[model samples]
Target: MKGRRITMPEPVHENPPEFLRNAAEPVRDHLLGAAPLPAFLHGADQLSLEDRRLLVDQALVLLEQNYVHLPLKTAMHAVNPVQRLRLLRRRMERQTPQTMPREWLFHAEMSEIFHSVRDLHTNYLLPDPFNDKIAFLPFLVESCTEGDRTRFLVTHVASGFSAPGFEPGVEITHWSGIPILDAVDLNAARFAGSNTAARRSRGVQSLTVRPLVIHLPPLEEWVTVSYIDLAGTARELRQSWQIVENLPSFVSADRDTAVSQGLDLDGDETQRAKVLLFAPRVVAQERAAEADESLPDLGAGEIATSMPKVFRARAVTTPSGTFGHIRIFTFNVSSPGTFVAEFVRLIRQLPQGGLIVDVRDNGGGHIHAAEFTLQTLTPRRIAPEPVQFVNTPLNLRICRRFQGGPGLDLGPWVPSMEQAVETGSVYSGAFPISPENGANAIGQQYFGPVVLITNARCYSATDIFAAGFQDHGIGPVLGTDENTGAGGANVWTHDLLSEFLADDPGTPYTPLPKGAGMRVSIRRTLRVGPNSGTPVEDLGVVPDELHRMTRRDLLEGNTDLLDHAGRLLQGLPPHAVTITEAAPADGALHLKLAAENVDRVDVYLDQRPRASVDLTGGQADLMVQGAASAHTAHLEGFEVGRLVASMTRDLS
Candidate 1:
């Protein structure tokens, strides 16, 4: 933590606010056995002219053949990355002076070509030092709205750092002598985002902490910040950037299977960086929880759960009602079963009035994890978002070769791709990234009214989760932003790409220089139901209602935002359908089922209609044939023929 302090003012209080105290806690500087903050980074220029050509040529091959969103990106941005790369290659070939420039310039050129597409799924990963490091200031800043105006506030100040009066809730007016908003816009332009709102939001977020994998370090060694303190006193501070090595690794399984190879490459690194910057205390708590399995429950309505890193559950009482609130930090977990099971246990602990599932700032991971979690909230069949690949000869080759291979089954897509050669279709037929039956297998776990809260930082698998929530008519979606990050493609690493770039003669395959790597969007996702066949890229999931972040939301514990969502929940009807017991008796299934706010119960065995019974008392014993062999039993509770509450159980 090295910096130049230019000003120091009196503290606003003898003790700082709790939010300030929580924000001031330092992150584990030695994350993943990495080094402490370094005063300066090691410098080197190792990229040769030949290395540059290899990188560019490989990038071109991916953009032309493996990238599924190329057609969409070309149409949306009106840019041809293929042509741009060809021109760059030509210039490199014609140069008389063979001397190589700085490595960043070459990396920047390659990055810029992909950035033009505005897709985070596709990127040019810098090698070694740059790849392993993250740059950060020891604080976090967020925004809130005052009527028509938006204000930036210093929401956090890292521990051991001295900022005097510039504590949490201090209004930031300027950055590096430029107006704060203008500076954010300037920084936003350098990053990749699918829309203007996403770019600007990410811009504000990246102002303090940037993962060097996707962004270059700030040119200025330090930044000058000007702001107004809590007492309306003006102040200035200079904060220097600190470098940390070995960002946290988030290697997850494929659909919770043991097949882990070729799957760990899809882990979300940017999400880990955000977790380090925004919620270090929570991260610290998670680490502590992991270290000690018998860690006591977090009081203040916090629920005890197995997955503390992915889920933070609490029973929140709002003006509308007492509801179960779960802040889903990220979907970057290995087992979807454990994730959803923990979710089910948490919701069951709270009052069934309603549930507010918050996925704000949740950079998504694992397609199956996100899609499989959707069935827990709704009675309707969960139709997982369909995925498509660009119709290319090389893609066909990879699909044909890797069909039924380990952790990489391109089988379902092969047939459609084979037919595309004659149909002249630009993309293969759409297929769900997750199995449809797996999505609907668990059925509805939460019967109360539900609402999902989202923001612009919601991306990839998070984007899919939001879309599935809306597409399935589960409940209203309340958003702090107009749309999600709109990253609709399944990203594949250069290692996966190499599987397609085989070792045959005359193959356009070469080892990436040094530790350099690339990731391309191999499959584009499409929406289901009403928006079926529509791409989820660029056009992200729009919220049913929008709530601006109030000052209370930033300074307090999202008090107003929860209140808004609670009121929305109040309007929707609530239902209760609990199955207390189930067993096979004689030749039929018997059960103790409880129903509230419903008059009828329709039973289905393995998705086949079995029997319909009237709900007279609150509880009843249910019986149907073939229960011994049936794998699942779905009970739909309805009032006057209108479905309200649904429950599913495993019969075997």
Candidate 2:
């Protein structure tokens, strides 16, 4: 008699075989009335019972982890067991596909598995497990691939343990078909080499080597001493005779002083100390080569020399063998002293007849730097002006705190313009319009035609420079298209809670996000453009002459902007003209001007005016300047427009 086929239910166990059908039956039943399976699983008619079980188990795990939290009733009639399992497996694989080891795997099982699925498809299911560990694991895996598992073995397993005294039997356990450690001794050996390599890479030779410290006298005092390395000291010394022999006379110590002190009379101790300081640092970096017989010595001299200090300068040589040079003066954005000194230096160096100032790459550091630099360039000092502040809802918190009493209780100390003035803490300073703030060169007269080079890269401080120059009519600008306008005085504070947490307490405190950084402008700067009452808030300084370059021009390394500037300095005709005018027309005043060299000009009027008249030349038209509520005139020059102004704003 033929026996009827029996469909057994899935079995459950602590650890079930890979092909156990019964193991998945319970899970499948649990999920049957719950979540709906994906459409791709419908074709799993060919899947065997065991394969179905595997898929069921995986789906169960995902459900339990909140990865796929479907309602029970919906999941019940979702799909057949085979199709459901297939879909579950596909989804699981997408979310958490196995990651490739950072380097080639060499331990037999890992090696085989790594190579087998090297290009395996990954669906973004599981978070990357080896992201942060990539740097450390590559060396171990690569070493194993090279058949030099000794380092891997020593560093990972053996180094941390002691050797067993007696002979011992070894037995290995397999987890997920991968062998676990068979013996303690073998594991110890693997750890030893790895640790050593890691230490060497970190510039540490051994636990005994402590960081070297050199004590110096106070800032106002100088001290001298002779030192010798003690016997058995691990620290190494480097020789500097080569450097001493090559020292320039001015830098080297005087022979008489050296002789009187009984020091190496011919040597410069400063240079020698520098050489000696680097010796142990070099030795600490040596590592065992792949072929362990010899250690690879990375000698001190192998390192590249320190980079030379750099200063940017522009030079032009005339046909008559005469040369004109311009060196840009740069200062830290916030530092007032540095800016003042540099401005003075520039004033002294600039030729009386013509000069070019470049502030193309200056990222603003300090507001004081801008003020001082501008003051030095201006002929007279302007009175301290109030920088306007727009009070946003966010700023009200700071204001409340400033007005409130100090402490964890934030209030009563809210900063106001009056309070700032009383405390002298406001950023306001005298604008140098007086002779004291101007040039004091003895030889050449101060009057000269100046040209400023600006570009898109010119930022905060640079923007200020351009504005100041234009305000004083210092010089024409070259190559300033639309200047990057990032100014409003961002509120920066080291207080993390005050910044990020004040806005959001839910975010975790992590240094990665700048410890909850919060920045908002506390003041609005009222900048006077060619047109008045125009603020320099969102809009930056626009160049009078705008120059646009093509990729081909850039590739050719053409500094045509600079060249055109040179021509301008030589009294050549301007490439373009930008005219902005405002008058009244009809009963109300109207204004208009024209520029033959302009490609397109945009006229921005604050409001409609009484009388307006068109100028003959096609420049710009507006109502009376101050008469109108506000009028902003923007003029676009032809290619030649690139050379006229550093920045332009619509202020009518």
Candidate 3:
């Protein structure tokens, strides 16, 4: 290999080409065969647009069929020469490599990427696989182009300076002895791909607004971490970024665990394992564990992570039996076993009547939370929808363990499954819910009935939980339209493909219109309900019953959904009540309450307890001295306190 300082010119737009932005000479040579590597890309400033095209034309010819993917190779011949040339031209127009040409990216489409194994461009790097990601850090920090006019918002760990004058969250104008924008922009330029997964990475759950990750490499004096801005816009700057707001830390962690697609299998995709961009899950995990040794506890242990007390176990007396009540705000800390343990305990303490699971504001967390809950609450085995990767060469290679080899039993792939694979555009089969998933579940099933409640806030994994309940007709769902649960199922992104846009040794990489490497839903989630084969990602989980929260419900904390659920579980009629002949004068309140199966009326004016009036024969005159205000009356005596028939009226 020719030794050269692989530097770029100033375009003052003078940046390393996208491929070189990620990879460098070594990777280029490995993929390009004996074709002479470009002499000096830094001199591109003097080259005219046509001159640049000539250079690209030559490179294209040299790479004609040498390193092309199987699908692309076939297409290259199938298409006419004019179309082929046009295709190549479009690639050049989109990919602005400061100097070198892209081998696997920019020009490469997502569909094209799937049917092809990554050449040396995105895969082969750093001599050591374990430390490959660690070696990639310097490119992100140091390789930005000097004098390029670009702006970036950089954040740091502590409230200290990341550079001498460059503080976190401040606009970095210069970096590493150069005007920083170009570097940030040049570095940022690589991630310009148009991937939908990246666009939809909003509402992602993290322990806090900013999730801090610090990595210390072995035998190295320096330590590195990924703070923010994998894409040009930092997450905080993005339009759809969300944090674990108003959620307990455990709940956030649980959802984070689920969203990151953490699995319970004996692998590194656990709560603590930190994987780097594009590295194989197995290797990145080992290095993360190794690097974790040097990290300070950083208050992780100091913070108590006990389960949040979300269950309100009260069994109200019903004609047949008692009805149980439980409210869930989120599945943040709802780990499969962790949540199941609490579920088992709460259900054990409840009366023999059916249960009401109030999931109003709960967005979801891990699927395992639902899985374990299913295992503990029901006797049926839970089966996850088949999650298959796209039919790309890299995916085919990665999924080979399931495709072939000694672990063939693990994969459900075979000749008979051809129709399913072809129809689904997927190469693998669904995953059977493993026993390890329900390790925390109680063996017995709950014979009592269940009632589910939801709203728009009942989203994501909560959608999964609701679907699971519907799968078994476990209960009636309330507080949502016919569209039912959140129409999103579990999604797995391709950070592997995403690595093409990351900062690496030879080339700093990214797709066009940069920023966004988050996961996409490769396999739509298949619901286990009667509508088998129908994905919840589209129609969502249909509800057995429907109800919605009114504006007053949101403002006044109405439990009408809960109330409706209780009545449904108890086979009782809807208790209707009305307030009329109302008058508020001289700080005195008087109202005629016409009701049925009523016991008494508890009135609260301006949220303060005011007075109570005992009812007789479902009628009472409520006269109480109070201020002129909006009053709420709880018209009760339906069954237990569980059944509260209430009404709201303004006494002005």
Candidate 4:
């Protein structure tokens, strides 16, 4: 069997393309890793036009690879043709410091190529269902290049398409290709003039005025490309010098034209008008709202208004004085500063008796806010102890300076007083405690029993406040069974990767150009109780007293815990006094007690007996002195109840 002889196709043109002339040799040299290729091949006199051209083609291939690999839309957008070319050159030449060489012509050409390819692929190859026919025509028109020879391809493709209500002259428009005219400048004409007018008109106006349609290249018709291909192509083109140099100029020109024509590019006519006419009024309104004093400054009022239905807090005061008066301050988890100051003020104003601070639904805020509140409430000042050095390092040694006098010239060894330094400690000296200057201006003279009411809703800075109070002996936490634990303390930075360019449906790539975000912990706070030494890193502060309530108590509107607290404050025993007879008849429970010196007697069943009780007037007949002038009690069946007796003194 004879092998077929391969025939190599001859070059169509005797002279290579300009880019090929400038790029080929440099690209070949870079591939060979001979001498380092110039950062910019276009400017180097050593590289021929062919070398630069070859380099560009090679750079385009590398750019295509990068575009294919782009995972995020933002990165794809960033790697425009110009950038792609620069990156390719850098990679090939192993340029240090990774600096992109500036090239204006390459960037311009690449930008145009990127947009054209992207538009074609998005509209022609992958036409979205949501796209309108009008937009489709414009997209095709915008994608055409000046050098394209097969101009009839676009017209042929669009000929069969029919859009209802689109007419040839009144509504529809057309454009013809012309050198030096950008897509934006290619003015669309209404319709072709009659045959008589075609012969009559001549020069630029003839083509400009007549309905002219630029043909799409036949090569473009065969271009069956995907989004990835278009995106890569665009990125490569954007890396070129031509596109990058004109970006700022293009943006500025567009802006200037828009402003001059009074065009609202954002299309928000009403908003734009409002901004233009009443900007000062809007600013004034904002300022006035900010300065509002009647508004709830730092806590629930702000949060409730901002986040209406999510969470809310209302300051509750009891109508009856039985439970005394307690101010329930609720704050949002975001803004603890306002609440901290308010809390500090409240603690300072507390009388020398007893105080019940409620933090039932405080979600949390800044750690500093909580710490500051604690500092204000703390009665004792705990300063950082100075560290002593036995043998200091030579680098840390201090030099002594002394002033010499006539008689004291002999005494040259004057040792300087060493200031004490701080060593390892949980709390830093950022905000130190001082007796005169550092003390809370409101003062912390309250020497009273402090109680804090907390629930599961209490979290973050609120938990910190509770912990600080408990740790510093500022207060005793009362209830905290249903509170949310501290979480989401560390702040995270967002890494945005892509630019949203247009409202079109079929734009190919969306990139997250950057890497992973940074996580930061703003500050460290201390927890309450015996574990004060342990930092509240991931754990929340635990409540000192865990009080659980039953549904029955809630339904009955009975605050048993509050009542118990009241009892404690009033110096009353917890259990009721009781007395029961060992023997009983008629299934009735009765208790009786007598004392010569006592005025009243109270009795409790299934509990301890008390001598103090008040009975109106009916209980006197049931009592009589029997054995040793002591009041006797009637016997009854065992039952759980309290009985009280009141007596008057016999003055006779």
Candidate 5:
């Protein structure tokens, strides 16, 4: 035979190469079509075979596992060698995927599998693969980007002896040698598999770090600390920033890429702690020197600062003579007036000019923080905007839990509201009644102009705060087109599928998987806009002025943010009105109101309006209280909702 062409059947598996056949077997079974893990995991170490029979056995077992969310419809339509071979052959012809290393290749396949199971955006998928004991500071998720690759900027790095290459403010572009974007995507995708009871039954990575990168930021450098210190530090950071810490995500070096290289496997799987690979841009001394001048002034500053624990405020006098201020508040807040006292103290130090509230790299804490922040800056009375929740089946369940038991409430209207919960509507807004968001600051006041410097890293409460500033014509916004991260709901996390499983217990409990939990969007928040349903989720507060990060800006760290705010203050609108004092008389009250940008103030008793006083002079006294039947004061802005306030006296 001079020349001949020989044909051979392609292998049955398109993913994971032949070397990973053994390692990927359980995963394949759990996700795709395979038998019960216990059935084969027992003898898996010695069950290597090049024949299609092994794949067929695994597929048969998968069919029995009842992976409902998978592509397969029923056991009758079970997987077999013939079907898998055909699928693999078809896949191979369509795309000749890169022959990447075992790590990347396997991870890519797992990522796809995870997305196929559930939605990652709404679910928690971070996996902890490294240290069991660790701390966390909020890394800027919204600002994490370099083209398509996301880089996490360490506002503050977690303490303790971490892996090598650690520092504050160093932008992390990778995690454990894998790019951070890919790692986060993979980690998020895997946990998405735990959407429901059935999927969670087989879902191993949901809320797990193993087999996926759970830790959002890559490890920088190793440092030493005692567990006591670690515990306190972790709690301190978590409490301060309201951040969640992830366990390390790791795989032993032997099981990593060893098979392809024909290396002997290490028997000690748990002994070897993996390491983090830092980005060359941040870590390389030569690279830093090259871009020192261009990027030095960028947002890089004191990562580890003496700013309280999480909130910091200080007056900054840029080179210009104009007086300005910078305030960075990390935690959104737990209550409305939680930070009022601190905020007032911060503002009191600033000279009358634009105040820069730097909410860069801040993760959301509390929902009321936005209004609470604005209230401290403006003494005007503003309307309490209402938020509507989409009464989706899932949301209704969460609301009901929060709604609490109807067991033995004394309130007369409690049962009626409970009945409404029973007769749940599709959209909560459709109903005549919805909860009005309540937040008020009584004494704090700042009448000066404010410039909000935000990055894509700004978050939930930041979104609300930014939008309020613009909506109320408070001042100019710098650093972005709109606010960065949007707030969808007040996130309340529970262990595993507790939100769904506690009452129903959808599936029988197996071993509780490690480092897994759920962050559920319990209540939907609507922002102030033309549309009552306008959500901060995607349409974050678009800035009144764009301080966008340009290519050059990134190189130079956008040092001009505060400088721009200072410039805007040159033409800032002067104070419009003021609430001077309230004097009680008999069963009535007299209020002194000063108006320059004079419009009108709508007075109210117990949130119910009593009078609308149009300003006739620079100063006037208006009688607001009558008989003292109800003790409340309300001021409505000039036809607008801005400059409004609702005040009430404690009868007790």
Candidate 6:
């Protein structure tokens, strides 16, 4: 799909896939049905007052026993979820059976208590109807700065749906009867956001799309939106909320794969929803590409890659320099190795002078993918962030129960937690989730100056990735907001939790009365390097530079944002270290290498230091004995005794 360029008054592009007309017809009808909810939603068995009390009690157990950030949330927010849940149960007991509230109301009350924690990783997933649906509008609204004021603009409108004069770039002044920005703030107060930036960003995003699994559907069936047309004329239109199926698949982590995980389930689901609404052509292309291993037809400068959903790369030409720009939409991939390998391949194909990585709305996926990707950008040995469990007897038993299981092995945490009984430690000893060797296995693949772009919507694994970048001294981080979403924990679904504790009858965990479920932060993450031991929750990684989104940035393919990143890249020094040739000859190693801004090269054979070669005129040739029999060769480039680049080559 060719991306549209900025034009004066016309909408960005009108070429939506024709297939959407037929595809969206039934969905729209279902949304406009007479009933407030679908028939399937009404079929659920009503829960008694006791059933509601049991559900609250069950969720409270996880919070008190397994939640890693309970103390932090309590200390920071001054809200006690456990106390609140207990009170909810007491209130349920006092009510007569005939006066029992509806099951959805009970679920909403429980969700409120969890949302008070301000942790997206922890949530109360509603039952049946709500879990499998999403509430969305036809278009998305985003805010951009104009001098000292912030303006709300219609960024994207779904295909097969149209609001005359309500196209992209039109300004939205009011929502229903309230001011647009005021409505966003009011909505932001209902969700879980650890910081102000995150709250506002999420509020803006939820204005168009909301996954019902983690959030209730919109209460109002229709909204009258007031906006200014391209001619600066005031206009008003009423649009109804649409209910559509939201079935996003999650790949679980095992010992052999991901070390730790931080995922935003709602964000993951809504990402697909955004594509389905705003870019249906891309969705159709994704299906066709996956079926036949074909490449999607991308716009000008956009790289054609197999993993189109996870990565979007283009060779951008800016005023500073023509460099590579890759936008990582999400980290929700199944294979971390393939994720990193493909990333390395993409960078090698782009102009090597500089690169910009944009992860603005990335709600993190696998921890391994985020941590391991860091080593490819810098020469420093990667230290994966450590994770620790809240010290408690239940956590100790849970660790022992799944020690050698295929899924989670809390065994490593058991020792410290057991020792905590006598030492009175509040948390288990921290341990790295991804192994250090695995992270550095590929070594540095890109040696050019690089800059990362982030926003408040960047959460979970993305937070870890940004943290590692800053901690390891990779490059400059440019953020659209002051900080990330501040979600830094490994989240596990209630289904997985039930499976782990199913065989143990002594456990209080049982299947919910309905299809209701919950997710909790099982392990909290800690930063490494200079910021060692600092928790990533609540206090997320602060960027080195901040750039507010501009009018051109929203309407012109991030023109201003990329310009800012390009300027940052131009100021930084670029380095290149390449081993052009390496081979065994006459019981010795023959190597030809090229270096830029490097004075010396260090060689390690099978991880043991073998030789140090001085560079002359940015080139070197060396012959060393015993290296011919080594299984691996490691190279490090240094300028003025500071290591700037590294590479690893297999000799076996």
Among these predictions, the greatest TM-score belongs to: 6
C-alpha TM-scores of all predictions: 0.89, 0.33, 0.41, 0.28, 0.51, 0.92
* Of 1 and 4, the candidate ranking higher by TM-score: 1
Candidate 1 local lDDT, residue 405? 71
Candidate 4 minimal-lDDT segment of 10 residues: 241-250
**Residue 315 lDDT in model 5?**
54
Best first by lDDT, ranked: 6, 1, 3, 5, 2, 4
Of candidates 5 and 4, the better by TM-score: 5
What TM-score does model 2 achieve against the real structure? Answer: 0.33
Scored against the true structure, residue 571 in model 6 reaches a CA lDDT of 89
Residue-wise lDDT of candidate 3 within 147-204, one digit each (tens)? 4422233322211112333333334334333454343343322221111111111111
Ranked by TM-score, top first: 6, 1, 5, 3, 2, 4
**Could you give me the TM-score of model 1 versus the true structure?**
0.89
Runs off by more than 4 Å, candidate 1: 1-39, 95-98, 252-270, 296-299, 404-407, 500-507, 580-592, 605-608, 617-632, 650-652
Summarize candidate 6's per-residue lDDT along 190-304 as a digit string, tens digits: 9998899999988888998988888876767778999999998999988766566653453544533333668877778788677656765555455555666556567888777
Between the candidate structures 2 and 3, which one is better when assessed by TM-score? 3
Write model 5 residue lDDT over 1-652, tens digit each, in one string: 0011112122323352222233222122211221121221233222112212222232222222212112321222232422443453344344422432232232233234333323222322332331132222212222333465433443322212132333343444444455544555654444432223212211211111122232222222221211112222311111111111121212222211111111000101101111111111222222233335332212322221222323444455555435546555444323335455556665666665556777754544444445556665655433333443443333344344544444311133233334546776433542111123334445225656677776544444555566666665556777553445444333333333242336665433222233433233333446554445565543455566766443333334444665676677766654545568776777777777775554676666566777777767656677765735555555543524445322234321
| lDDT of all predictions | 0.77, 0.30, 0.39, 0.28, 0.39, 0.82
Clashing pairs in 6: 1-297
Candidate number that wins on TM-score, 2 or 6: 6
Best by lDDT: 6
Better of 1 and 4 by lDDT: 1
**Tens-digit per-residue lDDT, 3-58, candidate 1:** 12112122333343233334423443243222223333445456778888888999
lDDT of 5 at 439: 41
**lDDT by residue for model 4 over 1-652, one digit each (tens)?**
0112212222323343233223222121111121111221224223233333444553343233322112222243343554655654555364332343333333333334333322101111001110100111110111111243211111111122223222121111222222323222332121111111111111112121111011111111111211112122211110011000000001122211111111111111212112212222322232233456232333421222222111223322222223222433322223334444545444444332444556554534333334444444443432211111121221012112112443112112112112213352222222111122222333243334456676544544455556566665555566535332332121111110011112424422232111111111212333435554444322445566665543222323225555434443343211111232222324433234323222334432322232334433313212222222223322111113321112122111
Evaluation by lDDT, superior candidate among 1 and 5: 1
